[model samples]
Target: MSVPSGLPQDTPVAGGEQRVLRFSIAATAVVAALGIVFGLMSGSYAIVFDGIYSLADGATSLVALLVVNLIAGYNASGSQNRRLAEKFTMGFWHLEPMVLGATGLLLSGAAVYAFINAIGSFLTGGRPLQFGQAIVYAIATVLISLGMAWYGRRANRHLRSELVAMDIRGWLMSAAITAALLVAFIVGLAIQGTSLEWMSPYVDPAVLALVCLVIFPIPLGVVRRALEEILLVTPTALKQHVDAVAQAVVERHGFLSHRAYVAKVGRGRQIELYFIAPAGWPARTLEEWDALRDEIGEAIGDDSPDRWLTIAFTTDREWAE
Candidate 1:
């Protein structure tokens, strides 16, 4: 199967594995649009704040889509095609740092702006939300948030994409904020439905704090990933799986003198280990080595734009490294 733009659709992806990704993409766009509408209609500073958050989330979806495309690797037409494809698969690695810093700044600015605006409104005699309009908006916001969370969790299960999981968290928090507002609305609606309404304006800070809390992790994750990639640390999970594969080869082949080194390259795995066997296997020895290479490729080769190349070498026992 292939995605329309000539991209490889056969490979499995976190969100792109079938039509699940289409659900996520469509959901993101809908949520963002709804958020903007509610923000404008209710004058609920919290909702407006969430609207900005939603915009960022929309941008994140765009970035994720780009990443998915890169991993799919449908466009290659030159001598550097392979290299470019690999780099594209690894694009998320490079994009994270820059995206993190910018998102941090944007979120911080928005929080500060909202807080200032809210305080200014409060100083000028905090205005109360129009019950009918605000209640409808809150309900819509809450429903959207909840829907996003559900979709995000589903996407996480399907795609195993960390970014999609993060999106779920973002949506969950947005939903929670809206849920809180819904409660406040109910409480106000109960206390003469508008006679007691200080809580509505007060909750913005709490929600704003939540937004900051959410933004805090994005940069940290980016930094952690960057550090690992920079230090060339093989991801423990991938390394362990590779080791198991290599060790099995050794055990099965009865090779006594073999050294193994494995590293991760983008989504593809790399094996840089050497194995040595006795020179007496005759024609069978070469056959075994060739079989090993093929095995390594089949077992762990992603061959995606974001794949790692696992290289295995074999030599006579005396020549083993």
Candidate 2:
């Protein structure tokens, strides 16, 4: 048997997260537009690629914002929007991993494509660019990207949101890329009219290739995590804790045995515990059973809206098995 318990959802944190994402989206749009325009004016493929990456990042952030809203609205206690809850009975936790996976794959693919293009350009004797225009654009973009990355990290300290964290990483990556571009542009500018001036044309493609190599592997961690959640892989730590709790409960209550099942999907933790009572144990009232369940829940800890916990007691081992 199971007793439904009420838990307060952190709506304020969710709202704060949404606000940060909206700000990021707006900033990304402006930066992307600037990148494209400056890239065309300066004839820098690296700048154009930066703009394209920002555009794709903005799209993923938009999707992340939607998922956050759905999760917050549906999970809120006493929410009147039963339509979503009714339709998505398992909750919106699954969407989190899907979004993460998509973001990682999209960003990784972009990096790979950029790397290939950089190689092709390098092989074609590289292309000369207006270092003055490119440097100006890179400096401005570096400042903006750094500011956004700092803001995201600061906000995520309290929020601890995966979407926001991913966004923070994106911003940092952007900042690093722009900073490298600024340095490359400066070197290219300094070498003009000198013996090293011949190397200016190769700087952009070489730096772009190096940046792509650095970025391509960064998102693989997120992808691996998302795949684990999507597969409903039982988290080892969570499973161990649940098993310990169940074993303690069985020993304390003198139960024949216990079965525990645990899995983590996104921010949600699903746990099921079954205590196998003796064959001829005395029957307890419904209230007593509920109290036992509460005890077990408290022992397991982490009482949150994201936790889906169910405890049952039965004499038949077949039921638990």
Candidate 3:
């Protein structure tokens, strides 16, 4: 495994990332509760959707936290725990992409459903809302969401965690949604005592529809990335880097040829390199070969638990192939 410079290799010491995620969970939970409460009080379906959205995000965050804990436990104790080794022979990297994909799908489904409801409401001439209460809720949620977003972004600069990146983006999305709601509610209130009073009833459904249109496709990118990991698709840039290193090793050592295979699964990069030694090459001690392997490892770089690197020297070209 080749870990990146200054990055923890998904070990227990990476607990700071978990703490950030927990903070996000707590913040999202509070916002969800507030959304549901103020949504009902204000009779705004848009606000209700916002609440449900936060609630769904919170649930997914809990799942993410659990996965993080499990992965940390595996990395910290797998060497000593026979059960864990047996249960996760390939490590827990696969779980990350799976959880991410499921969360994304769940979010997109909810948004689609909300979009349909919003459309139905619009068709029925929309619903009335207490713009004042809605505005208050939106302002509070916007502040909370922005705070969490900032915190997550700052924490991730050191952690460089995919989970944290997703968390930060979720918070930013929530903040944007709430900010939009605040503007709409304010506009609704502005028109309450004017010639546009008849337009008041349409505010809730109109905002809901707009929010849906904006957020419905937001999770698709997450799901796409997850699918790539799940499929063990080769990352182009990583493959190119690995290939270049393998080629260098082959030319430097006078090996007959070489082959390399690379794939990225979640946070893990799996690299396998095989070098075919010429049949008449001078023999070397096992220790010398090990030293060479270490040198090659250093050259490849990015050593980490999440990096699964296998390098082998073979006398037969068939083995390398």
Candidate 4:
């Protein structure tokens, strides 16, 4: 006998998460435009790179927003789109990891490309930059990026959304990059008329290379996590919890043995428990079995829409296995 809990129809989308992402996208567009225009005016490849990064980030964020909407809409009760539901019966949880992985890869690739350009410029004795224009751009970009990061973080305190969290990290990374550029520009300006004037041309490339080095490895963590989810890796903590619950149930009911399986995909938890009843044990009614499944579910806790739980009982070991 098997008892399956009611599967969630709608994965609720936090209103604040959508608002945060929309605001982030808007802010990214403005910052990206500013970065490109200022980079060209100042003849700074570093600023150009910053703009390109913002553009890539914005593009990925747009994709994330769409996925969020799709996940929220697809399994909703009374949804009119039967074709959509039929095509994606498992819901859109899988898309979350894909978006996260893509975002990490895109950002990392941009950093690598910028690093290469910075190195080439450095080797060629670097290029001249209008320090005044670069300075102004960096200061403004830093302020805006910091404000957005703070806002995203604050919103996520309640939202706890991965998309919003990733966007927050992007804003913080941008702020750090621009802040570094600001400092480098100041130094470059200060040394313009001094004995160190020869170093002015190299300043922009040097700072760009340094910033790239710092940021290139930052997204690897996100990529790793996404990969784990995509592969449906069994989460250790969840697996352990499921085992403990199954063990307690078996001991309490004097069952022969039990088997538990658990895997996490994105924010969704999938758990299955099988209990092996001894041979010649008295059979319980379906209602009694369902009540036992309910007890097991409550013991496992985390009764959320994202959880998919299945419990089974069988007299034959083969069936439990």
Candidate 5:
């Protein structure tokens, strides 16, 4: 959606570029279901674990989808004024990443469990694994990984969506894991009659576990960051940026002192900012008010060290003197 008007006191801003997140949501959901089905059908433990993690990814994707809709101005049929009224009531889209982050943590924990079982298998000689299944799984893994990497980066290009970029990394890691499984499985099968049967099976789970341990951190970090925002925790640098932007308007444009506080919403290249403006900034008349709005948009314009953004500006008529 186009950026919202640059007023914060009363208006709401939309955020999060649609390309990166929407693609991810659809892709992950499909892959999650595929992984679950294939894993269960083939009786592949590693694949089963992959399915579980994929399901978690699906959950996050669903969240991203919702957040994207919110930011993209998803609304029921209505006129501009009616749509704006709804927008004003809903505020901005800020909770998408929170859902993603939490889901990532759940996947990480599950990966840990998968990892432990892999190591534990040294005693049981590892479980019987289908070498052919490894190939199929790997193929799917690579396709999904490449697709995600492409879209995730594409999203970053358009909206600077680090979350989407993060998704790319996750998918790449999954592909790598599957590739390792395929290679190891094939090699072990070749040497099965000799001295590598035990080793072959062991290798698959060991590698899977190792991959899980390595890949799990990505989502965990995402989750932690998501929680911070969801819980009203603000980063020092972000707080500084908000404060700086607001203070600059006051100092340069003669806005009321300490009269505005701005907070950034959304993730990635798309940012939505909410701020207060002094009522007495020569905006007494209707035309002056409209001019003030234009001034705010130009001042904070999507050029505030951001590629895509929505900065909502609102006059503090009731509070500011």
Candidate 6:
């Protein structure tokens, strides 16, 4: 896959992901405020939980935005200040996974707390709510959640950002939970004049419990992925791709053997290729060797600032080993 400018498709651009996060921050702020106020007024724990969820998400989004700004300012090729360069000697790639992991952990913690509260409410014969007011809040929130979810997904088509992707998933989950709450509130309202009125008290806590249960597992994937990056695990697909390119270069250059090491951390790819030349092979000039390295780099196909490629040639097998 390739971008419009014939660049590789996975290349991260400057504005798109940040723009999406900014929009999410604004939308989440509005929702969080509304949820807190209406939840307090209507005495619905589910709405309050939703509000807190959005608040936590907003905080994480802010952190992510800060990291994004730092990364954008530290250009690999452009002029940079000595202090900033020294501070980020290893690049800001490590921060990406760290932020992602923190976001996931925070979300999971909130969900667990909410779940416990829901269980307490259920065991205590449930909590009564102003169904009419709750329904109104749910409808408005559902609409906003759906709108933001759609917007995030559309932006990700171009941005292809992991942060944006996670944000989109959050929006979708919010939409589904709020939509379910809307239906349950409607049912509770209808039962006010019937024999099933007793069941009305259980509706709020029941819905909240189910919502927490469903959303609890969702962030586990994000945590797992973040851990992999933090551990510097080599991605299987990327390793295979690098190995293929190294093999081709070795065969073409008539080298005795080659060794390749690759690892991915967030958006950064680290690759090292070492080739052992045959004993008594014809000597090549430094320029020629550099040209060969360039050729191999081009063949590897990911030419971006975040890519760290190192190629070495030596007649000593120990070096390649």
Number of the top-ranking candidate, with TM-score as the measure: 2
Off by over 4 Å in 3: 1-13, 77-81
Q: Which stretches of candidate 4 lie over 4 Å from their true place?
A: 1-13, 77-79
If scored against the real structure, what TM-score would every candidate get?
Answer: 0.67, 0.95, 0.94, 0.94, 0.70, 0.92
In the range 125-159, model 1's lDDT, one tens digit per residue, is 55455445656767876787788678668656756
Ranking by lDDT: 2, 4, 3, 6, 5, 1
State, as a TM-score between 0 and 1, how close model 5 is to the true structure. Answer: 0.70
Ranking by TM-score: 2, 3, 4, 6, 5, 1
**What lDDT, from 0 to 1, does candidate 3 have?**
0.85
lDDT of 5 at 3: 53
Better of 2 and 5 by TM-score: 2
TM-score of 6: 0.92
Candidate that beats the other on lDDT, 1 or 6, i.e. the better one: 6
Q: In model 5, where do residues sit more than 4 Å from their true spots? A: 1-43, 74-76, 79-88, 235-256, 267-297, 303-321
- 1 or 4, greater by lDDT: 4
Counted clashes in each candidate structure? 8, 0, 6, 0, 12, 0
Model 2 TM-score, all chains together:
0.95
lDDT of each: 0.57, 0.89, 0.85, 0.87, 0.61, 0.85
CA lDDT of 57 in candidate 5?
69
Span of 10 residues, lowest total lDDT, candidate 5: 5-14
Tens-place lDDT digits, model 2, residues 200-275 = 8899899999999999999999999999999999899999999998999889989989998887777778888888
* Tens-digit lDDT track of model 4 for 148-250: 9999989888778888999999999999999999999999999998999999999999999999999999998999999999998989998998899889999
